[model samples]
Target: MEDGTKFRNIADLDIADYLDKDQFARVLNNATSIELESGQTLFEQGMPARAFFLLLEGSVKLTRLSPDGNEKVIDLIHPGQTFAEAVIFNGGPGFPVNAVVLSPSHLVSIDAAAYLDVLYDSPKACLDIMARISQRLHWLVNEVDRLTLHNATYRLVSYLLDQTAGASDESCDVCLSAPKHVIASRLSIKPETLSRTLKRLSDSGLVEIQKDHVVLKEIGALKKLIQLETDHFPCTDKKNTLAVEIH
Candidate 1:
């Protein structure tokens, strides 16, 4: 499907910002544009990785199927961002996750081989690409750390605190862009547990859930709560170790 057409939206995306005119044109010439409706899956986990994409509009979720037949949310991609980038370097394999459109989306899919070919002549472009991949890798590492080293409440609170830190206004509001279950999966907790955590925060005057977003009413309390949860988490692991001494 690569008939050498122009992808006009490339100029505004961060991926294109690193590419020079010739470099940009090369990718466009080797790319295919796609439009898909909500609930459409672009690719499945373990599917061959022949291409990557720049989302021109709408939201997308990258998820993986766990061994227990459950799905885990890996990331939520926004407009102007790229996804499936790591697959290009995955080396002789398939995509690590499934890419599903959350809303009607416009995307430009660039052939992996063509994109890699252009990088050889552009050191800066290569570095930019690696940075994006590395950032995702870092997030994955932190995700593992969060899942294993803390409780569900601790995870949810930390998630809210992070969202609040990234907010642009003083309201300290966090938006729930995905379904509650999806968000819960991302935090490694159940949907019911997420609701209960939110309810408890609301009851304690620490947060207000008006609709789709949460307002952090007392930022200081949340900070303290997160620390308390971390330090005083049920001592199951520590308790096992102390069993010999106590007995």
Candidate 2:
């Protein structure tokens, strides 16, 4: 897809609501669109930072490559999410991690300097950018908490339970954002370990994994098995706030 079409697709997403039509058009005009095949590197750690990416289609994996040549997957980003926003202002170092396309993907890359200009020109855009950064930080913290559990089974089950919040109860189906190994890396577990954990969940009658879709047979029991404590994390109430800000 061209950069303009990719920007329009992004504009259709909820996150792009904060941008005005003119600003959005200017951003699209300044961005470069690229097509990446599976396993293509989008950016690497320690390289000069120049742009931030907005995923238009397919998935990208953000990973930190260790000195010993090991890779730790930090995040799996899908459509509508912006990556490397932190690099826009820091100007300290290049991307602290590597981003690679997990499948054939389309992305819109906005020059960091141009983006900063837009932010300075529009107060509302600045606030929206701040909110996005804050939201991403919050998610990273929560992901850390989820991975702190000692058992792989607990982590896998907890992940499934987390997916249920935005899911349809009648369908009880949730799509896996990436392949099993990629998700395993994100959870800091071996692929075999993830497979074993899934088998255990199935054996316990908690869920049924078919292809990339996990069908929840007993969500209540699965919640109980994971010992979920909902009170610890308050749900966000952004209906009116988002409506007013984006519109």
Candidate 3:
């Protein structure tokens, strides 16, 4: 997994979206690979920002620790996504939050200087990165608006509808890729509240909750329930954007 050749073969990286083959190869050639077991720390909050990581395999959770030691889960970085790209250009030289391995994972740590150099050398690549950062900022604004203005049920229902986007079938399966509590934190809902909301949805015949998967029984009805809210607060496929590094 550490080999540059191995990195090249993973289509999920999709480096070609922004960089050409030659540029992509150069970046990987300069990258240093790091592997971690589940629950291991990748970097800590306030650590000097020296590198930006690409998750080659598995999942990583980005979290912020409060002064009193409370943890807020900001995002779950999945494979095929890059995290902390903004750190490369930030005026401050430290990470704003901590990243931990959600499962056994392989990551490529691209030196900040090397990445910056490539961006400087390629206008197209630099613009691509900036556009991604802009999109993420917009998404965060939408997320905050949803959390503050919407109720728990609205938020949870919106989340469930979002999961079924782009599906051909009327029904879709959503796997809770992380623990329930972690997903609750990401949604800014109390764990018990999330449980109650799911139970209500199940009782009403909207969705069926298995151990870790939620099967939408009536997708159209669920979507219609939230249509008005979604009209005002549009929810994009945040995952598809590929540049969010929320801490």
Global lDDT of each candidate? 0.78, 0.75, 0.77
- Off-target runs (Cα >4 Å) in candidate 2 are 1-8, 161-165, 228-247
Question: Whose TM-score is greatest here?
Answer: 3
Clash pairs, candidate 2, are none
Q: Which stretches of candidate 1 lie over 4 Å from their true place?
A: 1-10, 164-169, 219-224, 227-247
Which stretches of candidate 3 lie above 4 Å from their native place?
A: 1-14, 230-247
Please provide TM-scores, in order, for all candidate models, with all chains considered together.
0.78, 0.83, 0.85
- What lDDT tens digits, residue by residue, belong to model 1 across residues 20-102? 98998888888888999999999998889999998877788999887898788988787777888776785857998899988
Candidate 2 global CA lDDT score: 0.75
Higher-lDDT candidate among 2 and 3? Answer: 3
Candidate 3, 128: how far from true, in Å?
1.4
lDDT tens digits, residue span 147-190, model 2: 77335755676667766777543437767878999889888789
Instruction: Tell me the deviation in Å of residue 90 in model 2.
Output: 0.4
Ranking by lDDT: 1, 3, 2
For residue 176, what is the lDDT in candidate 3?
Answer: 73
Question: What TM-score does candidate 3 reach?
Answer: 0.85
